[model samples]
Target chain A: MALPGFLRRERIVARPGFNRWLIPPAALAVHLCIGQAYATSVYKAALVEDFGTSQTAIGIVFSIAIVMLGLSAALFGTWVDRNGPRAAMFTSACFWVSGFLVGGLGIETGQLWLLYLGYGVLGGIGLGIGYISPVSTLIKWFPDRPGLATGMAIMGFGGGALIASPLSRQLMSYYDPAYDGTAGTVPNGDAVAALFFTLGAVYLVFMMFGAFIVRVPAEGWRPDGFDPSTVKQKALVTTESVSAKNAVKTPQFWLLWTVLFCNVTAGIGILEQASPMIQDFFRTGDSSTVAATAAAGFVGVLSLFNMAGRFAWSTTSDFIGRKPIYMVYLGGGLVLYVLLATVGSSATWLFVLLAAVIISFYGGGFATIPAYLRDLFGTYQVGAIHGRLLTAWSAAGVAGPLIVNSVLDTQGEPGSLVAANYRPALFIMVGLLAVGFVANLLVRPVASKWHEPHSDAATTPTPARSAAR
Target chain B: MSTSVSKDPTPNGQQPVHTPAALIAFAWTLVGVPLAYGLYQTIKTASTLFTG
Candidate 1:
């Protein structure tokens, strides 16, 4: 908790002729201002007609802010690894601007449990410490491209919902002139409490300019002519460290947490029914045949293939390695979920090109699992084992939208369903990409009784690896 | 670590890469003017659902 004095930690490092690409735009100015949690479905139909409620109580305020962003990134991931990223980006910009100033005084005092204790448990502990505070200071100043410096700050959490869903529909059409964010208008609720107090004072000045331009890499900062033994001769790349409580007593951290819970439960069975499963897989009956502005142009081409596969397949997992980039994301996501369950009703640009390459391997398995936990546990508790592997993305965001909305609500709704009622939820999302291709073919290495016994570079030496650089 | 590093490096030890042009036009309009106004409101509602 040191910071103050022009955000200390030695005037945010990089001084030696600065510019380590100015720390990926200061970690994309705090992940495109807390990737406005995928533009909270542009304020879920104005918080269900301004608190009239039920759309499952406004989808339990984004499922309690994604289960408090996986229980405050597994309970303050080792206090943002022993207080660092500028005191965890200034305590995540004061609990994400006091969770939008107590959720805009709980929507100007109507109070749905103080907007579920201000934006679901203090803005899910400011989206779990501003999402692992500048991810271990960009994997310690890009230790020679830690998966393209954590895929340029997890492609600013998919370009913060393409800049907060058209800037929250032009700030709720300039504070509601009888509202307009579609569906039979009306909901103003004091213009969504002045658009959650102008998105909590513009994400507290963009997460205090990513906590005063974050820093951290000093001890033997390598880069020039890298040569970490040519990335420790690739395959199962490790230098060894471990410790997020012995990385949850490894089996290579529960096989990379069941390979990121079966690749985010098979790309959240097509991002929780993308715009009514492409207008219920191309309707064709009494009325509909894909409209609502072409299912919002197929959810804007699946958010440009989930922000171009979080920086093109996590910068091609730094020249193909992180377990063959999860063997091309679970064996090319089990042939794009059996070509969207047998030729996804054969069209609509072949089911929008196999659900945009299975949502770009579900945003390149969350920007390549912290450089595959910094190549099997090393960069000392890779942002606390990527904050305990985002509790397998809050258990695949409640088991991939309850296995695709309870198998397309027991084969019905979605404009009187068809495509063989989403072929049994696309064959249970191809048996969750064949159980994330056998947990990325059982990832190995981290054995020597969970390393860290003083950075065990084979029972340490060289004056404790030159006093750990 | 050299009084918390910075302030030297060049005589072979790297670290000079700069990037000024007003910090690359404020980090490319801080993540490109909201991805160019979200791809101009998703290609103006996807060019009337792909020209038709």
Candidate 2:
């Protein structure tokens, strides 16, 4: 009935004085491995040439993965809450690395569906389970600093792309030295396949570190000095917990869903268009004032902001309360987007600075949401609630781009568009942020009807620690 | 139950146990080194945009 002792639940829960600090790194390993989802563009160009497919076609692979990420997370979330971190992490590791292996085989044999099946369907499932595995556990361990703890782990997701993109490029080049990853040059498809295999193996090792190292806190194990009473004093913070299935029925959960969806949509609007948007904003004659290399660098800087915001802003939320933290994201993002559309062309530095902060809020939105859930629902089913909430991300992943790209498409060619062309999309994003700001305002405490009988993890039994101070 | 309880610290409270500090360090290094390398590569690439 029980899983093997190696994978048993009892084996992994941290006893008192077990150094609560260790848990973040465990969560980071899984996130960093899976966060490579962002760096898909590194191989996107090569895949197009290899399959003789259109850019749109190769891009579907990533879109499929994101959708599946939302799907699997929602579906498997309760299982994760039930089974504990080790099982969820191990399952995630298997699906994640296997997605690569299968995709690599698909490349070796030249089957596009196989690649989708491998990377999209399977890998996306990995992404989902991997994403939420450590979340609830961290919140439980660091009830005092839930935002900072979850932020450190989720920040790893943003950093994953920074590591993966350059590493993917290097591996591709290694497989075929002649493949300089330039326009009109094709990467050796076999080399690309081998790169997939190598990446699969590498990520497997890294993800296993998370699978092995992760532990839930022993029941009733509060931090050395944390008092449980102060947690109840915060007006918006809930002492009552809600199950994930029941959480969906509450308006607070849905409102927060809208908040995350709007925040992600606004951020993705700029992120999806970063390279081209910058070029279009500052174009003069046939030459762009911002060079292609510089545009790429602009993305790299935004990536850093994205990573930094995940840690920085989310940590800030621990002190500022989650709702007010979101106000800054929504309200401040509106001003920044309007500035980008209105006077962004006057100065490149102005545009860059505005976009970076907005993107940071975008990253901040992802990192902070779990703690937000922990605040509303308590730790009992927070991970599952977080999983269900990520459906908002999947929705935004589709809608954010659709709104931006569809508007821009109607305007003109990508490289040829003027700053004026982006005005409609920017205005639309302002409206979305406004909607998000209102939603964050409306998020009251979860109503009493939906709450579980107990306020916290009364269900989880506290085990004996070997050495309590 | 009595076998190890005598050696356990804080018999009055929940006893504290830890994964070896060395093991925690080694495991962290396993993921940290790759992340550091990734950041290095990203910065290097981004720098070309600034300095180029």
For each candidate in turn, the interface RMSD (Å) is 9.4, 6.6
lDDT string, candidate 2, A294-373, tens digits: 88888898999999999999999999999999999999999988888899999888988999999999999999999999
Q: What is the lDDT of residue A231 in candidate 2?
A: 91
iRMS, candidate 1, in Å: value is 9.4
Model 1 bad stretches (over 4 Å): A1-10, A14-29, A34-136, A141-152, A166-170, A184-204, A211-213, A221-277, A289-323, A341-343, A346-357, A360-362, A369-469, B1-52
Residue-wise C-alpha lDDT for candidate 1, range A135-243, written one tens digit per residue? 8888877777788778878888787777778788778778987766665675477777888889889878877876776667555565555657787787788876788
What is the C-alpha local distance difference test score of each model? 0.77, 0.87
Positional deviation of residue A98's Cα in model 1 after best superposition, in angstroms:
25
**Model 2: how far residue A300 lies from native, Å:** 0.5
- Using TM-score as the measure, the top candidate is 2
Off by over 4 Å in 2: A181-184, A455-469, B1-16
Evaluated at residue A6, the lDDT of candidate 2 is 77
lDDT of model number 2:
0.87
Model 2 residue A19 lDDT? 68
The TM-score values for the models, in the order shown, are 0.35, 0.95
In Å, residue A247's CA in model 1 sits off its true spot by 33
